[model samples]
Target chain A: MTKRPRYFNLEPIMNPKSIAVIGASDNPDKIGHVILANNVASGFRGAIYPININASGTIMGYTAYKSILDVKEKVDLAVVAVPAEVVPKVVEECGRAGVRGIIVVSGGFSEVGRKDLQDKVTRSGMKYNIPIIGPNCLGVTDSYSKIDTLFLPAAKIDKPVVGGVSFASQSGAVGSSVLDMIDNEGFGLARFISYGNAAVVDEVDILNYLADDEKTKVIVFYIEGVQRGKEFIEAAKRAALKKPIVVSKGGMTDEGAKAAHSHTAALAGSHQAYEAVFKQFGFIMADDIQELLNLSKIFETQPLPKGRRIAILTNGGGTGVLATDALYEHGLQIAEMSKKTVESLRKVMPPIVNVRLPLDMAGDAEKTRFEAALAAFEADPKIDAIIAIALFQTPGADENVAAKLVEYGTKMRKPMVVVSPGGSYTKRQRQIIEKGGVPVYESPGEAAKALAALASYAEYRDSHVKKSR
Target chain B: MALVEYFEAERLLKKYKIRSVESRYVKSAEEAEKFSAGGRIVLKAVSGKALHKSKSGLVVAGISGGEIGKAYSALERRAAKYRPYRILAQKMVHGGIEIIIGGSEDVQFGKMILLGLGGIYVEAFKDFALRVCPINMEEALSMIRQLRSRKIIAPDRASEKMVAELILKAARMYQGGRMKELDLNPIIIHDGTYDAVDIRMIK
Candidate 1:
C-alpha cells in the first residue's frame, strides 16, 4: 500500500525552537515592532533574531541582524512584516538561508487583487520546500509554547491562558476579536492561527496539524471558504473522530458570499452544499462566533452525552419552558421521568411544582431540594444529560447551589451544563460553577445548545465507529 | 463547454445501468409514427444548444399514435429558428413522484451530486441536498432523508434505495471527467422502480 503524502508539517511553523523577525522596527507603532515586542514579552524560550537593514545595535535588548543571510545560526522560522513589494525578495533570501517556515504579515498581496506578487512569494517558498502561513495575516500563537506572533499590542488584545481548545481562522480581524472575546470571558486556548489571504497554508493544513496535537482537545474554525474541498473534508473527518470540531462558516448568504470573495478571494459556494458537508462529516456547526465559543467551552470541559434524552432542572418556570423549547429545537428529547422517579420527586417537591420533564423546583426551593432533584435525575436510567438552571436572584437559592452542581457534575457519568442568567450576582455564580469544572452559560438556550452539541458528537462518533467495524 | 444532446445524454445514463424512458431520434414524420405506436408519446425538438424546450414551444407531449404526423410537423415548424434540429420521440411515462438527480463540478469542491424534489419544488423552495462525488449507497440515502420533502419517500424503502443508487451512479460518471455537469430531471419513481425521463449533460 502506498502511504499518503503529507501536505503540511506545521511543527516548525507553530512551535519553532528558533525564530527570526525580519523587518523588525524600533518604532512602537509599526506592526513589525509590535510583533517583536510581543514575542519577547510572551516569554518565548527559543532564540530570537531581529533583522533590520539600517539598525546596527540591539533592538528591544535583542541583538539585531542586518539581513537574514548574515545570521550564521540555523533559523527554523522567519516572520516577514515588510512592505508587500519587498516580501518576495525577503522570502527568497530566507529560502536561501534554509528556513523551514515563513509567515508574511503584509496586506498588499491577493486581498487587494495582487496575485502576481503573492505568487512570487509563494514560488520562492515552494522552491525551498518551506511552508508559508500568510501574505496578509496576524500570524499564529501557541499558548503552551509561549510563541506569540500576532501584531496586535498586548494592551489592545489580551492573550488567553493555555487550555484544550485551539482555533484556526481565515480573517485576521475576526480572529483577533474572537481571541479578545474568549480571553475576556475567561476561556483558555491551546493554539490560534489566523491565516489571512492564504497564499500557501490554509485551514486544512492547520486542522490536520491540530488534530494530532497533544495539548488540543477541541478544534475550532472560523472559515469563510475552503479552497481544496476534498482535502479539507478528509482532514476534518479524521480529526472529528478523535475530538470535537466546532465551525462557524461566514458566508451562508449570497450577500455574505460576495463580501467574502473580496475579503479573501474566497469562493463561498452554495450554502446548502456547506450545510450538507457539515452534517455528513459530523462537525458541530455553530451559527455565530458566540455559539462557537459556547460549544468549544462545553466540548473542552464536558464529556459527550451517551444519548439525546436531557432532563432540565430550573428554579424559574419561564426559564424552564425556554429550556424545553430550546432542547426540542436542537433535536434533544426532554426525558420522560419514570413513575418511580416521579413518585420520589413528589415527596419532597411542593404541590405547585410540576414533576414532569422540565422539573420546575419552584422559585423558593432551597439547596437541599436542588440536590434531591439532581440526585433523582442522575439515578434515572432514561436521562442521559442534565441542564440545571440556577436562578441566583431567588431568596432561597445561595452560592452553595453552584457547589452542589459541581459535586454532581464531577461525580456522575452523565454530562451536566449550568445556566445562571442575570446581573452581577449571577455572573459571579457562573464563574464559580465554571471554576468547579462545569460549563456555565448566561442563557438557557445556550446551555441547551451546548448539550445538543455533545449529543450530536456522540451520535457522529457512534455512526463512524460502527462503519469502521 | 460542450453540450450533449438529449439522445446522447440518455445513452450515457443507460450505459451506467440507470433506467431511462425509451427514446428515439427521428428526422421525418414516418419515423416518428413508427416509434409512437406503443402508446401516447412526447415529441421534442433535438438540438444540442437549445435548452428549456417547453418554454420555447419545442416540446409537444401527450400525443397519441394517430397524431404523430401532425405533432411532428408542429414541433418542426416551432423549432425552425434553431439550427440542425431533429425530433425525439419518447414514451409518455406516468404515475411516479418527480425527483431530480444531478452532478456538477464546484469551483472550490470538485465533483458534487445534488438531489431534490423536481418540478415546482426545486424552482420555488430550492430544497436540495449535496455531497461530494463517490458517495456510497448509505450516504446517498442519508442525503435523500436530509431533504425537507423527505416525507414523500418516508415509507418507501425500495424507492429510497433506487434513488440512492441512481445518485451514486451519476456521481461516479461525473468523477470520470467525461462531463462537467449532468442533470436527470423529473425522474419518475413508483413501486420501487425509477425511470430517468429527461437528461442534460454539459461537457
Candidate 2:
C-alpha cells in the first residue's frame, strides 16, 4: 500500500503565531519581497522573514535568516517565494528546521511541466511528512483572523461577523475577484483557498475538511476538474447532504475544456455526464462567477425556499418584464398576487402600471410605492422569496430603499434581494443599500440566482431536517 | 452492431459463465422433432442480423411433432432471405425476472457496465445505471441498488441474493475485459435458481 500522509489540522497556518518567508527578496517588485511587505501591511502578528544570501542584516526591518535552517525560532509556516529550481532545496531546509507547513507560492514546477522537480518536491514533503500547500498557488487566508498570505496586490477589508461560507478556487485570480465581490456585498467569509496545480493536495481533501468545519456552513468551489472521478463523486455526495456545496466549474466551453485538460491533466467528462452527476449528488452548479457569488450571498443569508414560487417587485415595466423573462428562463414562477396584495398594490400603483403578478409600481418614483409593493408581497403567503430591481431613476429614490426593504423583509421572514443595473450610482447610494443589511447584487440574474440557490439549499435542509425529526 | 446469432452468442456467454437456453442447430424438422421429443420447442431463424423473429413470423413457440415440419419450413424460408441462412431450435425456458445487463466501452470513461430494467422496455424506459470498469462486487451492488428498477430485486418479485450474484458475475466478466459487449435479458430467477433466457456477447 502506498502510505499517504495523515490528515492534520491546518487551522494554525491560517491563524499562525509566526510565519517565515523563505527566499525573501530585497527587490520590492518581486513576489518574494512583496509577500513580506504584504504580511507587514496585512497586520500579521506572526514573525516575517526575508531570507537572503550575502545581503544586509535586514530586508524590511525583520532579521534576515540566511536559510530556515539558520533560524532559531520555531516557524509555524514558511512562504517559499523562490525560483522553481531552488524550491525543493528550500523545502528540505525548512523541513529540517521543523516547519509545520510550507506554502510554495512560486510556479514553474508542475505548472511548467517539470515532473522531476515535482516528484522531488512531493517525495521530500512525504518523507518529512509536511503538508505542502502548493508548488504553484495563492496561499490561504482566514478573514476572521485577518491572516492573509495571499499574493494578491490589494486585499479587501477585514471580514464581517463569523458565518459559514468558505471558498475554494482553482484559479487565484478568480478567487480574489470573488473575495472582492463578497466584500462589496458585505458578506462574511469563513475561509478562501486556491489550490494551485494541486500537486500535493486536491479539491476533495479541502472539501472533506470543510465538510466538518464548524465555521463553514457552505462550501463554494470553483473546480476546473477532478483527479479521481469516483472519489470526487463520493466526496461531493457525502458533503452535499451535510452542507450546501456549490460549484462553478470553469471550462464549460470548448476552449476552456482544452485548457482544463492541459492545466489539471483531468478528463473533463462530457457536459451531460457532469450535469447528471451534479443532479444525482445534489450539488448546485453555477454557470459563471457572477452566479457563483450571487448564490453564495443568498445561501449565506436567507432561508432555503420551500417551493419554486417567487414574487417579483420592480419600479419600471421594462425592468419587470426583463425580470419576468429571467424568472421563466431560470425555471422560476412569478407568484400570483393574493387578492389582498393586489388590492394593497393598486392603492399605490398608478392606473397605468401593470400591478398583477409583478406588483409594478410604475414610474411613480415614490418611496411609499416601493414600501407598499414590498409590504404587499411580504404579506402574500404564496411567495417564498422576493426579488426587487430598484435602479435609481428618480432622485431620493435610492436612499432608504434597501433599509426599508430590509425592515419589511425581516418582518416577513423572507429574503428581499435588491439589485442596481448598469449606470453610475453614487457610492453613498450603494452603501445605503448594503448598510441596510440587505445583500445588494449588481445584476438581475444575480438576485434571481440567489433566490434559486437558497431554494435549492432549503430543499436539502428541509429534507435532512425532516429526516432527522 | 448486428444482432448476434443465438447459438453463436451462447457459445461466447458460456465462456463467461453465463447460462443460456438449451439450443441446437438442425437442418430439418425431423431432427428438431426427435431432439425435442420430451417437451415443446421453439423454432427460430438463426440469423445474426435478424431482430424480432417472432414479430416477423419467423419464430414459432410451443411446437410439437405434428407442427415441427410446418414451423421448420416457415423458418427455413425466412432464413433464406435472412443473411445468416441458418435455423435454431431450442427448448423454451421459463420462470424468473427480466433484468437486462450490458457492457460498452465509453470513450472518455473507458469500459462501462449498464444494468437496467429488462425486456423491451429496457430501451423504451432508458432506465439504467453506468459504472466504469474493474468494478468490485460492492461497487457492482451499489450500481444495482441505484437503478430505478431496483424494486425488481425485492423479495416479493425475485430473490435478492440471486439477483445480486447475477450482477456481480457480469461485473466480473467486464473486469476480465475479453469481451466488448454482453447483454442478458430475462435472467429468470425462480425460488433461488437463475438462468439467462437470451444472451448476446460481442467483441
Candidate 3:
C-alpha cells in the first residue's frame, strides 16, 4: 500500500488561477515575504493566501490565513517557504487541501544530504498526486503571464516573445545569468526552469515535459550530469529531430567530475564518450555561455546551415583574420566566392579591398566594403553561412551599415551570425542586427561556434530530410 | 606490443591454422640436441621474460650436434642471472617477409584485431590498423588499407589473398571471445606463402 507519485503539466503553477504562499512573513527579507512580493508583482489573478502562525494582520497587503486548511477556495498552486523539518508536514497539508502543484523553495531535502527528508516529501506528493517542482530550487517565470515565481530582480523591459528557445539549468546561478544574458545580449527566451537538486523531479521528466511543450522549439540545457543516461538520450533524440537540443555540460575535469557524480550520480563517463553520444543524438555542444546564447539566437532566427563552409565579412584585418581562424579551428571551410557573388560585391567594394576568401575589405572606411561583402555572400550559392565581424573603429564605420547587411543576410535566409565587439554604446548596432532576425555574438569564437552549431543542425536536417524524401 | 615466448605462442596460432616456425620444447640438453641435429636450429629460453634470447645470451643459432649443450649452459646462466626460465629449441626460418598480426581489445569497440609490419620496425614506425572483431574478408581488406605505410601491400611485397586471409582468420579468433589477445609478430612470408614465426596468446 504505497501510491505512485503523479506528474502533471507545469501549466498549473505557470498559469495558476489561484496561489497560496505558505509561511508568509512580515519581514521583507524572509523567504515567505519574498515569495508573496514576487507573486504580487507577477500579477497572479485569483485568491491569494498569506499563511502565518501569529501575524497580527495582512502581509504584503494580502489577507492572512492561519494555515492551508484555513484558505477558503480550491488552490491550484502552493509556494512553500518554510523551515526544513516542517516542509514535509506543510506539503502534506497542501496535498490535503487539493493543491495541484507545489514549488518547495526550501533547501534541506536531498540537497543538504538528507535522504530521509527527501523521502518524506516524496511520499506526501505520492499520497496526494501532487507535482512538486523542487525542495531546493529557484522557481520558474512566465514573462507573458507576468509570473515571476523567482525572487530575483526582474529586468526593466518587455518579456520577449522571441519564440522557440527555453532554458533548463541545474544551477540556479547559471539560470539567473541566462536571464541576464537574455536582457543584455537580446537572445530571446520562451521559458526558463532551474530544477535545483532534482530530488523529486529530475532532468528526464522535465525534458519529457518540454518535449510536448508547443512554445519550446529549441531547448538549451546546462547540465552537470544526468541520473539516467539512456532515458535522457532517448528523450533528447526524440526532441532534437524536430527541434535543436543544445547542451553545455560542466564537468570535464576530475574535481568537477567528482562534484558532478555526487550531485546527480551521473556516470559523467569519458568526456569523449559524452561527445560521441551527443553526436549520435544530434545535440550541439556549446563551449561557453556566450556561444550558448549565440546558438539559441540562430535557432530562433534563420534556417539551419546547409554545410560547414562559411564566408566572413569584416571591416578590419585583425577581426577578419581572427574570425577566419575560429571558423577553421571549428572545422569549417572558408567559402569560395561565386562569380555572381563577386560581381555583386565588385560594385560597392573599394578597389583596394581584397575580395578573397575572408573578403577582408579595407579598414576604417569599410562601410561600403562591408555591405558589398554581405551582398556577395548572401547571393553566393556555394556559401552555407556567413560571419559578419563589425568593429567600431570610427564614426564613418556606420553601425547602420552593419545592421542593413544583417537584414540582407536574413533576407537571404542563409545562416548569418554577427560578431560585434565594442563598449556599451554598440547596443544600437546589436539591437538592429537582432531585430533584423539574425544571430549575433560578442566575440569571433562565439560567432564561429554558433555557425558550427548551425552547420550541425543543418547536417542533421539534411540527413533526416533526405531520409524522409 | 608485449611478446609471449615461442612455445606458448605457437599453441594459440595453430588453432587458427596459422602455422608457426617449426620448434620443439626441450626440458633437457638431450632434447635440445635432438631438435638441433634435425635441421638448422635456433635455441631459445622459453620463459616469458626471456623475449629477446639473443640479447640475453640465451640463443645459439645454426649450430650442429655437440653445440646444443654449450648453448643451453650459456642460456641458463644468462636467464638465471635474472630469474628461472625454460629452454626452447626452434628451427631457423629464413628468407621471408617479417610482418606483425595481433589484437588488443578496445574499450569502446570491444575486441579489435590489429595488423601491421612486423619485427623491430613495428615499434619504430608505429604502423598499425585495428578493426572490431567478427571480421570478414571485406573488413580485413579495410584494415590493410588503414595502415600508415600501406605500401607494404605492393604486389612485389605481399600476395593480396594470403595477407587478407590471415587477417580474417585472426579476426575470427578474437570475435569468438574465447581468447583475450593474440600477437603473432614477425609472421614470415616466403615465396608467396605466409608462416607465423612467433605468436603470443593470452586468455
lDDT of each: 0.82, 0.70, 0.71
**lDDT (tens digit, per residue) of candidate 1 on B139-199:** 8888888888877844477767777878888777767748877777778776568788877
Give the Å error, residue A321, model 1.
2.5
Candidate with best DockQ:
1
Question: Candidate 3 at residue A33, lDDT?
Answer: 84
- What candidate 2 keeps of the native contacts, as a fraction, is 0.00
Q: List the residue pairs that clash in candidate 3.
A: B99-B118, B100-B118
Model 2 CA lDDT for position A166: 93
Report the lDDT tens digits of candidate 1 across residue range A309-391. 99999899999999999998878889989887899999989899878979889999888889989999899998899999899
Candidate No. with top TM-score:
1
Candidate 2 versus truth, CA RMSD in Å, comes to 8.5
B11-130, model 2: which lDDT tens digit per residue?
666776777678887888899998797688888775555554554666778888788888888778766877665677788665556677766553344555666776666657766666
Tens digit of per-residue lDDT, candidate 2, span A1-469: 1354434356656667788887777786878787788778767776776686554688888789788888888888888888898988888888898988778888887667797787777776677777777778888877666667676666344344445689999888888788777766656689888878766667777887788787887799998776656666667757887788888887765432432201011122254345445645667888888778667766676666657788877776777777877777666888887888777777777778777867566655567777888877777888878888776765536666656766765556777777666556635565566655566777677677677767766675665456657
lDDT of 3 by residue, B1-203 (tens): 33445555566567777767788778887887777665667777755565444546766777767776777787777778656676677777767667777765433334556677776666677666655455667556655765655666535424767788988877776566365556676788776687776655655
